[model samples]
Target: MTSKPLISVIVAVYNGSKTLQRCIDSVSDQTYPDKELIIIDGGSTDGTVDLLIANNDKITYWQSEPDNGIYNAWNKALNHAKGDWIYFLGSDDYLWKRSVFEETSSHLFKAESENIRLVYGQVARVTKNDDICCIEGDSWDYTRRGIVADGICTFTHQGMFHHRSLFETYGKFDESFRIAGDYELLIRAFKEGGAALFINGLIVAGMQTGGVTANCTKLVKETARARRNNQLRVITIPWLISYAWAICYPSLKSLIGDKNSRYLVNSGKCFVAVLSYKKNAILEHNNN
Candidate 1:
């Protein structure tokens, strides 16, 4: 790859007229010159097509057609992407800063040297009330050990940058998965010993507290399927338990205040810790 390889930023949308412009503007205003914006719209009828038409000059390539789901849209974006690195963003999300790609160029080159196919950074989450919360990249481990043991996704899609070759090697996102496809893709890459690097800076601002993953039941179920498909049965047990807990959590929060609900949740954690400690102590005594 060239020292300044072209970075392709892909945004997948569906009736996102409200937030589409902001997403386009964020990419258009990037300090990095060697970058292209590609948009894959899922046949939006909410004036989103008109907005894209208005800003056609800014986009490298764009298309509007009905797709199965977000992952399918992303796969279409991948087919059109012509950059050395590809970054996916939702129409509701935007680059966190104009210099995000500029600032991360050196790290990207370093990753290339080390044969790392994935790089991700921090993300600023914009809540429903417009409050911004910075989520750090190192907030959780994305290493193979961490993924297999925990069966959880540590990185957010908006902040992740993928070497275009990753798709060719590991295969495209499974369109069959309505949700959790990103998680499943990462699990496959990690399991295949793909190297990933983390950059400690904000890359994108994600509109949070919504989306398909917001449906807790569906999220849990899809996540379980992803884990099972990846042969992560050890983590499946805890995942199922967590799914049941999630189902009851909303009712508990509604009955109790947020503060009391949190306290109750912490109490359960404490109980688990006590049991774990006792079990370890018993095992040590028996070994002695």
Candidate 2:
């Protein structure tokens, strides 16, 4: 008898017909065979569904319909993933190397079966123009230190593999957050989910240099929101709300200038140290 693919790959697409072809091709080129690939479309009117249909046989299953939002789309995709391990690759991104699947699965099997919850690899940034910026030595080796710290993010929905139940433990992504939902979901994963490993190779993501995040103003605002999430459980909920309001108080001159910066500066220093060192930071993440 033959064995099945160890990972189930999901590609989430919505009006991504422009780049969906490259994304699908990357997954098909994966050296590891026997994996199932699922594409979930959120009712694209721009021929995205047609592109997915042209290669229908390669996809395990795909459908187009109205949905709540991106995170909700991801939750729906998770339901269709049936492999021993699951990886969610966005339609706008492609895998870096053909060996990515094999490399990620290598770590998955290396850990004790009971200890394997998820495996995340590094990511290469491909720009909006499709220019690739491969950054080596950025793996961060999530398993050893974990990936829940501030300023630390796990990329490559393409290469982040996990056991099916990892999602169950943390629950689904919070739909309330419009911009920081993925960050919130990953925070949930590393904080509450079980064991995980990080591979030291580049996986795949178009790290568009001029993307929304690159714009300094947007980055600053989102950084502040992420900072609030970082402090969510450490302080009382009411206090946290006050702290968040303080951080968001751009209307006041002291908020933007260094006049009232001492509290924030000191708080950020503590956030970095405490976030990186916790043995199982997830337990502390939701205490509030």
Candidate 3:
């Protein structure tokens, strides 16, 4: 009989003692036997190291040191990972269910034969209180055009599994990117003809809101950089509009205050939705 492939779960955290244990527990509770947990701490001073010590037996490898950012920490963790498939989990995020690895491995086994480098599922974005905001993810076929054209990341990293071959071929995450380095790597791979498989209706993890990726303006700026780094044009219409919105959002927020800024933003979104509805309605009438 053949041995099951090992999956490495890498978590990068800084001062996340409040939720770190839950993240670790999520991995430890997994039904998959062939899995390892690797954690990289960014010199957290908030007793996070103590928690790491408490759960030392459950971790395959862990380290505490100062790092530039999340990508840097992830790069560090990657050095110690020995699994066939790699998944990056956030400190504030948890596996949606204990069977995540068990279920995902089924697809991975098939993906291996097909030479697929990326396998992704859906992620639920949840509030701090555990209320789900929305589920995020889509097939590469549905998202490739947007990613290639505008550098928009439709799938959450927490829900994606990367084959070790991907790292061996394309190299690890770029350490300089404070955000969207994942996007750069994915864009590079897809644009270069790497294959990806999407597992339909598989909700892999729950990503908590208000993390580093929640900085919309900074994320947008990093996204543009990621696109340019991958040789993608920065002047695409979708990117232009997103860039404009990102640039204006902060100024508008500071000028008006959080409450009003949110109202104004929601109002703008509603107006766009209404226009889209009206246009669709007219088109339907014409066709009828």
- The global C-alpha lDDT for each of the candidates, from Candidate 1 onward, is 0.74, 0.59, 0.82
Top candidate (TM-score): 3
Ranking of all candidate structures by their lDDT, best first: 3, 1, 2
lDDT of 1 by residue, 175-245 (tens): 88998898888888777455677776554555454667556567667877887888876354335455665
Candidate 1 lDDT score at position 152: 44
The total number of steric clashes, by the backbone 3 Å criterion, in model 2 comes to 5
Local lDDT at 150 for model 1? 51
TM-score: which is higher, 1 or 3? Answer: 3
Off by over 4 Å in 2: 1-5, 112-114, 134-156, 192-195, 202-288
Query: Between which residue pairs do clashes occur in model 1?
Result: none
Model 2 steric clash pairs:
5-34, 125-207, 126-206, 126-207, 191-282
Q: Write the per-residue lDDT of candidate 3 for residues 2-23, one digit (tens) a residue.
A: 2377899999999999999999
Q: Write the per-residue lDDT of candidate 2 for residues 1-288, one digit (tens) a residue.
A: 123336787776778888889888888888889688888888999999889889887889888998776677777878887777777776777777787776666566664354667666665555566554444223333322323433433243445676777677777767665444666666666654455566664454443333223333343354346547755333333223334544554443244543333234324433443445553456667674
Error of 1 at 166 (Å): 0.9
Local error of candidate 2 at 37, Å? Answer: 1.2
